[model samples]
Target: MENAEPFHDTRGFFDKIGSRIGSQAPAVAHHINPTDALLLLQNYEESEQGWFWSTDAAGNLTYITEAIASVLGGGSRALLGKSMVSLFHKTAEGDAGSRTLPFILTKKMKFNSLEVKAAASQDECWLSISGRPHHDRSGNFLGFRGSGIDVTAQRRLSLDTARLAMFDSLTGLANRASMAKKLETTLTAYRQQKRTCAVMLVDLDRFKQINDTLGHPAGDALLKQVAERLLKVVGQGGEVCRLGGDEFQIMLPDCDDRGILGDLASKIIGSLSQPYSVEGNRCIIGASVGMAISPFDGLTSEDLVKSADLALYEAKGNGRGRFRFYSKDMQQSAEDRRLLEEDLRDAIAQGALELAYQPIVNAKSNIVEGFEALVRWNHPERGHISPGLFIPIAEDANLIWELGEWAIRQACADAAKWPGKARVAVNVSPIQFANDLFPGVIDAALGASGLASERLELEITEGVFMAETNETNAMFQALKGRNVRLALDDFGTGYSSLSYLQTAPFDKIKIDQSFVRGATEPGSRNGAIITAIVALAEALGMDTTAEGIETLDEFELIRNLQVSHVQGFVYSKAVSQQVLLENLEDGQWKIEPSGPAHHRNDRLSMYRKVRMIHENHVYSIVIRNLSVTGALIDGLYDVPVGTKFVIDFGEGQLALATVTRSNGSLQGIQFETRLVSDGNGGLCTSRRVSPYLIAEAGLDVPNLPAGYVPTTKIERDSLSLPAFSTVADWTPTKARPK
Candidate 1:
């Protein structure tokens, strides 16, 4: 190596340092020279702290100081002739610019202070490698010489810092910022390809209960299990991230099919809702999923995520443990929720809450054995309010206890007014049941009403026993001690634990309606569940009530299974206190049951209009009936059966259907995935056309119920155009064999 004009004054610097050292010590055997100084510097490079290394023209290590080779667990020649890049690499695999020793060597420029991962020692090693290019006098390329220092501890600290910034500390999943960046990247890339992606925003239901009941540590553990289950369900095709607290986001790439998305969402909900075993205690919870798709629901990440959030709000509000897709007309505004909450507080305070009674009929006698009291709210000015709407808010706002107390008292009082020896049943929330004062509240309600405890029933769900199992059992025993019948409501619907049934003081088991709804259908597994539950109830010496029996088929099935009681629309719609009183005054509790002889296979009568697209042509039709699997429609001109048509139910809702049966203008068409509950006594397709797309299509913002309407005018496609090649002078009877 040469310097410009003159070489560095190495000899003078050595001589000055040597004389100063000699004058101080005066006992040196020999004077130190530049040669000795160079030797000492070389020796220092061979120590454990630092090392010198060189690479050949081909980027293979020619020589590495003995210290580095020893640190790498070998003699001096072990790593010799190995690719220099093999010794160290970039901390992150995809990081660019000098990712490894070879990559930097390719630049062939003097470089310094490049950090690379080197796992040469027992602990992790990061090498700060510096290098200068060397060549012969003829300018022929030779190689590179560099020095490396151990920076293991510092590098690990930097990595830990980066991890804290990107990963959730509690759950070890991607944090909010990391999730946002990943979503942004995926959306941007997918948008370019015109491919679709789906994002599901999940909020764990009743997560706060864990924090309140157990502790934050247990909650943290539950969160970890939740992450693991999500990872198991999502697999490698999607990314699951914890966006803080109980909210998690799962991103599915290249997926836009709503049927698949809905199934996946349902799976996630089911998986997450299973009872969590935390520190030997069972904790039951649920999740609500809100899904939105890209380039359809949104073109940007923010818009898509916001759409998902809105859908999630609807899911939670409608009732937790369900999934909802983004829709333009969904009204889950915070102001509306808050306003309802405020009104709910006032309504309960004002005694505006009322109870509606639905009789629980004995399967054998078809007589009213007990009446289940359902709470209803009439907002004075707002008319009748649905419990589905207000009950969740009450739970969220901590007003459920007040509502529960009123319902209990009102139920008991109404039962006291009845002439017959009928019992009254009231549903209890887990929150209310968890309180130590629940037994006192029940006694007070019964006392205030002057009703016999034997004539009243307290219904509790399975969740009541999941946490504080022993305490819940104590509560159960105390309630039963009051001579009030304790019925387990919605049994086998959620996280059902047989242990609870074996131990808790339950007088009866109310089979959840989900199993009863389709039990009579051919080959339905619900029948098996119903029968099993009935057998279990009988074995445990508890009565069984099948709820939600809307048809005679369900009633007969319950009778065949020897279920004790039936409560559903088939018996009676919940009636006000006065209506119930008038019925009771007739002196008999017997009411004949009548409904459809058999299950409808989920088909329902409907009268609606929708557009049917056949071969790019739109036809207007009126749906005479609808079901999850298919629909019957009228209004089309001699359309052939077996023709595939896209059914447009407006607001971007589209379903592919085939005309399976056609007689005159009436036709039967089938859908893809069965329609799920829209949470409002309605059914809707999972995916909808975005409002942005509608605007781009130059159409008005429309609601879901409205059938497809063209931007200009809603009309059928004209059929006057020549649909195929036509001869200029061809006749029907012309000779064609020429």
Candidate 2:
């Protein structure tokens, strides 16, 4: 080892040994002769791309070549034999004086490249360091040697990537992935220790609408503002992460008290409910929060997330701006609703639907003037389901048009079977009205049934006309030209009813059942309204119908108000066509009179009687019966068919009844009262007639006047005396005052 020509070409010895050991130990075998090793190491150390260094057994930096020192901003001579600890300024406690020393002692550690901040310039630097324990030929551990290469830019890029991976660019909070990872770890730990945790799913309501109406920049600003607000409100136990697009997920760990979850939820609601000023516009966005607690609402991450999501949907459904907790019943309800939706779609395709007719009767006459066709679903297993249950589902699924078409067709077909005078009222959903094909559907249904359009009445709520534009008006006008009667159903319920009634094209208005049900109560506002509506309809020349007339009182009240029609369970629940036909055939039809009837022993009596007097003699009498055909008195009134008679009573009691002798209106009149007062202190109501004979006599009044105007004294006196009177002197008849 004397300075013997410093064996520069020691590469041959390393090659020979490397050849014997194969390629694995080539680096170690290359440095064989101590002088040659020093020369080669010096050459490597002086190279710009490669730097060499050695660490002693005590983990001190014993040697540094000039090339390594230059890259680190110093000459090799200054760093040579200097302890590595002298280069590093320790900022954190417990950091080893030089991190490289641990690697040297733990020669089991290996590295292709590593990054470090250089102590010389205090600048971040990267190095490719590979080392093993230096040993003699006997394999005794001596020291460590490694090479270094600057990679400061690459190290900085790596740190940046790590930061970007965990943080959101806009809000600077943890992104979904990072938050999820943290949440999972926290949840797992909490579960292991039997502690509590909460997962909250927050959805900003109508945010899309806001984004659409405003601009995206405004939306972004609003989002940033929301993130800031959430950050401020999250408090100590929780962290908030934007899941994306108006949605955020919060994880509250170490929150042992479930009550605190509710409190936090309330705080969030209150905080978000406050108006936010964004881009010079005050934006108000409501938030719906659904929360799930660990080991209570759910145990696993998936379960918790799903439960919270379901609850969030529920909160949104309940008009938003609130929070809801996960519950078993809610889950079951959701499942059932899903099943119902599926079943409803299938039901429509299977044609398992039918229409039932509820008779709309004359409020005064109690005659079934028309029928309102109500849809019914006959599910194979579920029996009959009301429209209240499935109609909403159909509407939600956008299947209302198809279902509405079917209903219209069925209703029109049923109306075709009814008498020509009977009209069929079919409900039109708002969705159907919005559909462009609604008019075509109506025409097709009417054509398919061979029913006249006049016999079809389309009933819609006032809401249908809420957006009253030219298009809606045009559609309504077209329908009107087709002779389809447009009826305002459930009138007076909507806020725009008055405006709609005045503007929309409608032939009839049906007072809502709610009003009709309460019509008979004393001082009931509904009763007063019903009376006014009936009067208004009469004045406007439009028909009015009262719905939900289930009691006699309701019926009487409506009739007294002079409403044209009534429909409810009192007359009949919506029944099948066959039942209706059977009832019609059984001659069980009864038309209630317009006025209240006095009842004795459960039988209608004390009828309001109308009689005709001709030439100062009783010509005939027509009594308004309560439960039977209106009666007609025959004073040998063997009147021919279509004979119009002036029914006169001196005291404003006069009605005209055309005698249809063959069809026999007189036969239908049955007198239950024996002594009906003549209203002038005389009780003369004796009319004994054979039922068969009465049935044969046609007393039909073809031109029956609705009511008679008062007769002038001049007209009454103009009646001539009988032409066949004898020559005997006739005495003038005089009335005796009672």
Candidate 3:
């Protein structure tokens, strides 16, 4: 009995351990004594699968398994008196269960399967620890008794799986699903704070061609490069994510200004569109961006995403290298575009499409040398549809081949009847040029029309260079073998490569209209660019044509630049075949150049209804023409010069203007603040009325228009009489003048 004191003194510790597993140990103790149970506990501690731990009333460790102490390189006595919480801390990798270990011990509560890692280990080692409060028979508080198993391998597996789920494996950017969840959560929090957020959807143009040509590994490498470039441009301003393949998404918090968004979008487009060298192969691609802002565009992630997608579709439809912000009117335009595509499919069959030829005259003599055949679609309902609108649609709908073949045949046939040896140039889409059957189509057209091969010119663009050099050269040889003239069109618009000029057998280089439009302006580098282009053409034994010379200044600049040919409205609009023949009835077809005497800012003529406000009165007016600096409007009678008015261009755009000139039912007003580009070849105000203000004004935030009346109380006695009278019976002209 005296020697039994050793067994009796440790009886409580053994009992607590026994109760944790079940009553099995106590039942075995009824048959044997405490000595045998202690022996069994010692054997269990020697096995290192799991280690047992007990803390004193103050959370200091009283006992630790011998195996762990030795493995830790500090024997049992060195670690014995340390705090249990200090020995293993919560894992910094955000293990959820381990986060509560300290609090659980402070409150003296039971906890199970908590995760932690050793604080002093050289290599990371994680543990899954379970503990409960140990108490006396009267239920007074004692300390914690716990057991832990090494969970380092399992933790590594879990973290790896989580990373794969949340990030793109190839680009290492956030994946689509992770972005969606983040957007939703962000929107939810921002709604409570009444803050703004923006989203941009970017779709890469011509990525498929590169993918198909260069192989999948190259494509993957290109995507990684794109991601890196995006991060550099966006920096910490936004979260950039790859939404699989060629699509990416950027989320910017606390931003609502379209000007800033547009600039960022343009930078992204310009950066991504630059040539990329992947695996030593040069590749070019473009990007289109669609943007949406929260609380104005949508209140939820799904709705905002849809708006951005629609804007992206519009940007791609108009032109690939551009960006568009979400607008209320885009919903209708999208539907109309779909219907237009269907109508375009039937246009060739129904004979609704025709070619109109604009003269390409010699710059020195103003003598017509040839005509560039532009395809025109006269929709029965929509009147004349611009090629700028329909050409890309045809390309997307796969109708370009059929339409292109028809155009080549029609253009040759029309030129066969000309009185002189004037040539006809037909545009060649890259898609058509890539086809093996294109040469035969041209041969058939020339044969059927009896037009000379020397008089038929095919105008190709730099986009054709996307193909292999061997294939492109082969196509050029086949066309040249037929004595067909090759003109490289839109030479400086995109991906301009000297390599293309050196390889392709081009007889002419046409300066893009964009260069010519601004070449005469002061501080413009476009003139230098054109001079270089003209010099390059001359050095290569090729001719140059300047396109879209709409002013006398531009005409003179082209002549001074020694560009060989000029084509634009400065001479005349595109004429019908009948008109062309009538003009050709007289010999040589020499025409005098005439247009506006001086260069002016580009003005877009259209009929758009808008609200004009003077003092407290509002009147409806029609804008006949619009420009960045001013507009000519109708439906206001005899407005005096210097009279100020507020013009409302709907969807929250407002501008202050003063009348500079007036006539019966018409006035030309200059804007106090110049309008900025809307990025769709249009002008818009740089700022808009805030949706928050609209809500505060007691108006429906979503449906509010521009130029709302002030909510602040106004003294009626201080109001002035209206400056101008509305023209109630005023009728617009039947149509826009050509």
The candidate scoring highest on lDDT is: 3
Please report, in order, the local distance difference test score of every candidate based on alpha carbons.
Answer: 0.78, 0.63, 0.84
Query: Which candidate do you rate higher for lDDT, 2 or 3?
Result: 3
RMSD of candidates 1 onward, in order:
8.1, 29.4, 5.8
Per-residue CA lDDT of candidate 1, range 300-322, in tens? 78888999998898788776878
Model 3 / residue 303 / CA error / Å: 2.5
| Candidate 1 TM-score to native | 0.81
Instruction: Give per-residue CA lDDT, model 3, range 1-738, as digits (tens).
Output: 111111212345566545544544455534655456666876676667787877777787777676676555476677776787787765666566777778899999988888787877778888888888877767776787778888899989999899999999999999999999999999889877878889999999888877877889988999999999999999999999999989999999999877788899999998987778888777788899998888778878998899999999999998678998888989999999999999999998787898899999998998999999999999999999988889889888889999999999999999999998999999998889978899999999999999999999999987777635466778899999999999999888777879778878999999989998777888999888889999999999999998988989989988998899999999978999999999987647888999987778889999999999887777899999999999999998867899999998977788999999999889999999988777798888877776666666454555333554447554567756655667874346432111
The Cα error of candidate 1 at residue 397, in Å, is 2.5
Tell me the deviation in Å of residue 521 in model 2: 4.9
Q: Check candidate 1 and list the clashing pairs.
A: 652-689
- Candidate with more favorable, higher lDDT: 1 or 2: 1
Best by TM-score: 3
Model 3 RMSD in angstroms: 5.8
